[model samples]
Target: MDLVTFQNTILPIKDKLFRFALRIVGNPMEAEDVVQEVFIKMWNNRYNMAEIKNHEAWCMSVTRNLSIDKVRSKFRRETGIPEGTDWRDEGLSPHKSAELTDAVSRVRQLMETLPESQRRVMELRDIEEMSYQEIADLLELTMEQVKVYLHRARKTIRQQLIQSESYGLQ
Candidate 1:
């Protein structure tokens, strides 16, 4: 594609890519770096872009892989920063209610406790509002598999909420 086409099509997805990276890496700065790297990769591979189908899904898959790779590298090096930092608070500011903030934090914690596959699926399907076919394309899973994972992820989250309500976090 030409530069104009690339800008019009590719640049629009940067926010989505950043969000996906942030979801995986749990750090906004690192996610921004990942998105930059993804754009660089796309630019470098621009000549071959025409051969690929579903450019958005391809970009998302690349973002997912790059973000996971970054997380793995950080893990190997032992970054002391703990997970589950509330990255959302800065955006909410003083507008959103404290109860909503706490609930979001709790749900984020619950999401962290899930298996990686389930967490990724939940983030893509629910948080990103992606369709099953799009998710399957991005994750390289079958449509049925994507559905199953999303179902299980939601079920697990629901069960956890029920448990938390009934017994509290003893």
Candidate 2:
């Protein structure tokens, strides 16, 4: 593809790619770096762009791999879990809303405890709203495999949420 066409086509997808990377890496700055790297790689391989059947999928796959690599590298360098700023203190809420929000927060925390593969599947399927085939293609897994992993992840999350609600974690 020509530079103009490539720019137009790929530029529109940058935000989606960034969002996917952000969720995978759980860091906005790292996600931005991943997106930039993806576009740079794409630009470098512009001559072979036509050979790629699905450029968007290709870009996403690259971004996902790079984000996973970054996560692994960061984990190795860090001794404990990474800390991020919480924004929940900004809002005022009724008792019911507060309780529900707290439950949701707890669920998110529990989600963080899941395995990376399961968490990625859950994030792509649930949070990013990606289709099964899309997720499978992106993650290089079979559709059946994606479904199985996603089912297991959801089941684990549901069980944790139920336990937390019933026991009321202090």
TM-scores, all candidates, are 0.85, 0.76
RMSD of each: 2.6, 4.8
Off by over 4 Å in 2: 72-100, 168-170
Model 2 worst lDDT window (10 residues): 85-94
Tens-digit lDDT string for candidate 2 (32-84): 89999999999999998889988898998999899989899989888533576
Checking candidate 1 for backbone clashes, the offending pairs are none
Runs off by more than 4 Å, candidate 1: 80-85, 90-99, 167-170
Lowest lDDT 10-residue stretch of candidate 1 = 84-93
lDDT, candidate 2, at 78? 87
lDDT of 1 by residue, 83-136 (tens): 656676554547574657566778878998998888899998887999998888
- Candidate 1 structure lDDT: 0.86
